[model samples]
Target: MKEALKSFFGLDDESDDDELLSKNLNDDIAIDPDFVMSTDMLLAAIMEAYRVMDRDKDALDLFLTKYEHMHENESLRLMSEKKKKDPSLSSMHSSKEEDKQRLVQSANEALRTFFKMNNDEDARLLFRSLNDSSRTAETYIIMVGGLVEKEPWSGEISQLYQSAVQSKCLTEELAFLAMKSVVFSKLDGKMRVLRDIIADTSSVLNISPEEFNSSRYWQLKRTLGYRFAKLLMWWRNLSSSWEKELKLSVRQLKQGRQGGHVIDEDALRCIVKFAGHNQRDDINQGVPVSDGPSEKDQVIQNKERKYGIKLIREVVVDAHQTTLYNSPAFVDDVAIGFCSLKAYDECIKFVKEMHSRDLIKLKQSTYEHAIYAAEEKKDLKMVDELIRNMEDGCSLNIK
Candidate 1:
């Protein structure tokens, strides 16, 4: 018995367990004829071995063997004629619930042991070994919370997220949870995550980038625009080079048929915010109110500022061409906005299109909008012509 204990735990004679009726196959074999140990002692020793000297697989095999023997013994004891005692007691002998709890406990213990054994490697490998695709996704979902905290940038975390997204057995809510990870990754500034999310989202929304960049996908474009606006607000004081990089990055994405569907009010707001002059006329003090980015290297700084403002403004609205409007319902306001943006030709073209589509009737507001558009062109002749047309169309004689 002492020898067996030593063999099991690499302990000496003072070690605990001694099992009788056990075969010793190590050739140094000996079975203790007089030794006796309780099942409780055996369970305790197995748990201890798990903690101290990891013979986890061996311990599990031994536990299963013990379980079969104990189950047989209990069956025999229950069937005995001497045990025909009490009906109530026999009814209470249903170990199903206990068996369920034991199985759950064993599963938890196995997971603990497996995870503890394999920290440095991807834990997905363990699930793969178990051949459990659904469980793999579930485990990845749980692991992501911690991974997002510790190593959010890890490629392994990304792989796990991808697996969860591709899972076949996911519930709708679970699938959304996986997509939420992709959104967070984009918010974290991962272009790869952003691209994947955009592709999936476009597929679900039945939109392609070709139709997306015009007037088609306003809502989706606005969502991304809001996110970009928040980022631009944070970039208030960064250098001109950074600003240029940001603009160029967006342009590259747009040209590549990626990023926001179209630049709308929200996106324009972001651009305007970025291109704002930090200084304002303080009429009260009769001087300039200046903040952020001192006037050092005035030549280079002024050049960049002028170039940036002009560049981004043109990117949003071109004075030489008709600007695109998102929706046809409020396109009159869009036409006026284009006029305000100095896009006279675009304003004229837009109003013409709206009239052709019967979207804007020949009414007082239509004449007024046409007048505004013509006035932006700085042609008194065109403006007078529109006034005469307005009088003819609406039959208003107001001079």
Candidate 2:
């Protein structure tokens, strides 16, 4: 046994045998066949061997089992040591809760080891068994972040996200990760996954007012709204009708607004573009369908476009009021939306407001809209002034 211990620890010299023997046993234990290594000592050796061999899961199992049996043989060993030092200390031993915590700590370590190994399957399994105690949002982020690129594990990733949220371990960082992963996933029903993440994020944020107003929370909200709107546009064929899609888009926007989320520029642009673009031709190009929309359908279509542009205008004004709006591309998109509605005056007004806010160097589309608005009013002076501003922006390569 001493020789094996020496081999296990990589001690080859005969001189090390005495040292190894003394190292693993008490000074008073006599050398006899019956004087076997204590359970703790033996388990400790095996656990170390497993760790050295990179078998972290196996090491964790043995460690947990040690706690399970610690009440018997291990307690006596501990009591004996304490008694020798002081009689009063003998009565105090580690509680079961402490042992459980130790077990959890070891398990968490094993999880981190597997994560470093890139053995995601093993890490995921261990994470499932882990107690929420001592777990942080970063822990889930690391694991989920690793799995996001794996493509095939989308469902599992979603499940893990749900579990983390339920465990109250989901933070703004993790929430963003979950939403982005599901949005980019190749799997069908990505829309559903995104909605779930949005709902989960909102629910989690509702509990913490400070976090609810955090910059990270705002980022997630904007991303969620933008991605979902783009996704809805992609699923145009799946919608039973244009009006349904329109209602769904408006409904989602309302939810974001009611939930204290700012409907940022990208999301507003997606919805406006979706509402403005007619899918009647695209839907019927290569398939059998009615020649055109019914009169009622036409009115709904008009309402969809007008209502979407209205929302865009309202959100832009609100963003300006809050001083939270700044995006050149968004200005361009809103300009296009206004052009579609023939609200050229409103479009130029919006651009000038952005300019007055020092959001200068606007995009060419915004400048074009402002120029068109000037031409429509037969104001050549205004057009030349707009032309000068556009040239200055171009000289600076603003576009």
The lDDT, on a scale of 0 to 1, for candidate 2 is 0.56
Question: TM-scores, in order shown?
Answer: 0.28, 0.50
Where does candidate 2 stray beyond 4 Å? 1-141, 150-246, 255-261, 264-266, 274-309, 321-324
Candidate 2: give the clashing pairs: none
**TM-score of candidate 2 relative to the true fold:** 0.50
Model 1, span 258-332: residue lDDT tens: 443444443333343343233213211111223236566455445544544453445444322323333332344
lDDT of each: 0.43, 0.56
- Return the number of clashes found in candidate 1: 1
| Ten residues in sequence with the least summed lDDT for candidate 2 | 280-289
